[model samples]
Target: MRGSSGVAATFWSFLSISSSVLALEQQPFQFEAMSVPTYTLPPLPYAYDALEPHISAQIMELHHGKHHQTYITNLNAALKSQAEAVHAADITTQVALQQGIKFNAGGHINHSLFWQNLAPASSVDAKSSAAPKLLKQIQATWGDEAKFKEAFNAALLGIQGSGWGWLIKVETGKEQRLAIVTTKDQDPVVGKGEVPIFGVDMWEHAYYLQYLNGKAAYVQNIWNVINWKTAEERFLGTRADAFKVLKASI
Candidate 1:
């Protein structure tokens, strides 16, 4: 009887230890199977109506709340469905997902920057001016601020379809120079070996409600709210070596 009792106790103890070991073995697999990150639309830096007169409140509401939200949703969905391919670094799968990722990601990125590049015209101090360094650079590159605006507006007005006009700083040999460039669709300016200082959305949705096919007028008004302070910060913070490899490849 004593022997039988000892055997029964030992069997139960072994069962308990085996169950614990199995649980421990499954933990890493459970962790590894965790879901991929879901991207969300970021909130505007200012109120929806903060950029009013230049950019109407209704335009801001639709552009930020609806259009931008859709991009974020699609991006998250694409990333989630393609998690395995992305994790394995599969080139074919990555190529398949690239366009969708770029379009949506570009929309999100572009809109975010656009919001930061504008402020209330009322906020501008009557006596204040653009950061002196940025102003000096603009003058040097385009002869004067007026000429720069003329060139920038011309570039923006020339976009035949939905796109953005950007004022970018490119490293030329040992020095950086300002240039105006346009990108079709929702393409971003970064991969071109340039740092974008200012950008204006030339998409109809950005102005059609208020300007009604008057893209040139829309471009002109946007400057009233342009955030020169932000542009100056970007210019000052840029490092000469930041795009060294990119410049070399070019």
Candidate 2:
């Protein structure tokens, strides 16, 4: 419904999917992108209908191309506008650009993670290994996996409007625990530096046709396609970064 042009959408989708990873020759911690991170619509890791029966091809195409690309376009525009306003010292324009930057960038970051977090159910190789780690963390925090899922689902369904239901690892505490958190309308999870290891998108565009109005079914089914290796890498990466400050002193 957003960038609905077929040519533009196809071009972006292809470019994103086929684009090779940018090699970073720089040192560690150099890529701390918070305010002006040049966000791009990451290409889906598989075919548009790769996860069919769970997510439809038509829906996937529209969601990735139209919806996701619009956010990236708007975010880049906001960044350029912000730079100009800062140079010209235009307070009014500067104030207006702030909201757009955060909203659009948040949308980009959120969807980037969302795409990587999924795959065809048949493609998952480490589900058994990574699932129990998440479960143990969940149960330790919530007392049981069922209760953890219920709370997680409640957080998802309780979104009055559009937002995200996140299972964030609160690394600040002594033990690793999964916290059910909600954010309103494309809010950034790491703007203040708290890392988000997992997120469940509650937006209608995320799960409308497949499960219809069955939010619970959709939430339950999301576990099937999770790329646990990627998730574990993200978890260890974040923890390694955060605890680095502590480890340095010790």
Candidate 3:
């Protein structure tokens, strides 16, 4: 029922569909029938306060528990509605439901990746050394690590409103490169041959309580908690590896 205007405000509890869920980005979510599988918010890999000093416990609790859960809740609602619309052959209702599905679904996918993309600030995974291969590609693309972070932070700050900033590994033919990209609102990086190495949630809810209006501060401190080991894995693996959590989560 936590949907936007113009959509039905009804929600239903659903049974877990499949034990083997495909990587979300690789398998675009489809609404076929009433038997759709429900999405659940995956738990954080570390404690809520694990990234302390850089990201607050309060923010992590609300961001993961409340915000991310809302996306799953609403996504289930929208998908359920889409199923009914399809059954009735009501093309109008089905068409009107796409926005909610895309927004909430993107929110779920983005946050799922975002949570795994971070580590405890003191963990070795947080260090650039944990990602030598990715670091080399970054250096090749942006001159050096410092320049890469500088460019990524600039992209984060330049976002006009709620969105995300991502460090993505792009491949074309025999060429491979690292790039910084941004997605508006709850939109996700779902490009072919592109793997999202790590993403920073730029929504005000992500940093407003801790950083207030100083989003730049939030952007900078975020580097200290990034899961570079995970980044290295994604950069070296296929796009499916970037969202491997989807295959494990309910």
Q: Largest TM-score belongs to which candidate?
A: 3
Ranking by TM-score: 3, 1, 2
Candidate ordering by lDDT (highest first): 3, 1, 2
**89-159 in candidate 3: lDDT tens per residue?**
89999999999999998999999999998999889999999998888878888899898899899999999
For model 1, the stretches where C-alpha displacement exceeds 4 angstroms are: 1-34, 87-91, 125-128, 239-250
Using all chains and alpha carbons, the TM-scores for the candidates as numbered come to 0.78, 0.74, 0.86
Write candidate 2's Cα lDDT for 1-250 as tens digits. 1123434544554465343233222322453332343555666888899867677788789888988899988988898788668656799999988889889878877777777667787874437366545556666778986787688778888898889977676655444445678998899577333656667788888888777788778777776766665555455445333222212221
Q: Write the per-residue lDDT of candidate 1 for residues 1-250, one digit (tens) a residue.
A: 0134444544655575567456656765563565665666667768989888889999999998998788778877777657767667687987899899889878876776677677788775211275568788889999998999999999998998899998887865667788999999899777544777778998898888999977778888898888887676556544322222222211
Residue 12 displacement in candidate 3 (angstroms): 32
Instruction: Give the best candidate by lDDT.
Output: 3
In candidate 2 the C-alpha lDDT for residue 225 amounts to 68
Q: Which is the better candidate, 2 or 3, if ranked by TM-score? A: 3
Better of 1 and 2 by lDDT: 1
In the predicted model 1, the residue pairs found to clash are none
Model 3 misplacement above 4 A: 1-34
